[model samples]
Target: MSKEYLDGIIRRSLEIRNKYHELERLHHGSEWTVEEDALAYLTDAGLVGRNIMSQQQRWPKAGSQTELEHKLGENIWWLIVLAKRSGIDIKDAVNNFLTETEAILK
Candidate 1:
């Protein structure tokens, strides 16, 4: 995707996250901690593994394609959100990783 499209996605994700934080503050008297966000991201990451197992026919219960797709998107969203919260630029981090890995392989 173009950087503009990716940035738009990130912007929208942050907006939604902020809205949720507002609801959380209203109900709980505070927003979620970064640790809590990490926990949530880990939970969804586990779901991604479970979905993969189901797809491989190793899981007892079949995973819905819709659920898997949603989880995948959520995982990426969580990563982007987490990076922003940690004061890291997600785009730059990704680019650096790619460049380094490519160089290593060469």
Candidate 2:
């Protein structure tokens, strides 16, 4: 992706993180650390996995694909937030990983 696209993602992710923090402060009287946020999103990703399996089996309680998509987006947002908090440039990190993987494959 272009740098513009990555920057937009980072901007939107930070907006989402701020909004969530505000809501969390109102509901729980505190915001969680980046580590906690990451863990929570990871747990949500697991739920998405369960939903996928249930849908595959045609189970009654299975969540819709839209729900899974939303959860996946949330997971990405959480990752961006964590990276920001940890002083890492998410775009650079992703690019480095892709480059390393491609070199390994070659």
Please name the candidate that would achieve the greatest lDDT relative to the true structure.
Answer: 1
TM-scores for all candidates: the values are: 0.95, 0.83
Candidate 1: segments with Cα more than 4 A from true spot: none
* Top TM-score model: 1
- Which residue pairs show backbone clashes in model 2? none
Sequence-dependent TM-score of model 2: 0.83
Alpha-carbon local distance difference test for all models: 0.92, 0.84
Model 1 CA lDDT for position 41: 99
- Residues 1-106 of candidate 1 have per-residue lDDT tens digits of 9989999999988988999899999999999999999999999999998888887778866555778899999999999989999999999999999999999999
lDDT of 1 at 85: 95
**What TM value does model 1 have?**
0.95
Q: Candidate 2 on 5-67: residue-level lDDT in tens? A: 989999999998899899999999999887788789789889778767766775556456778
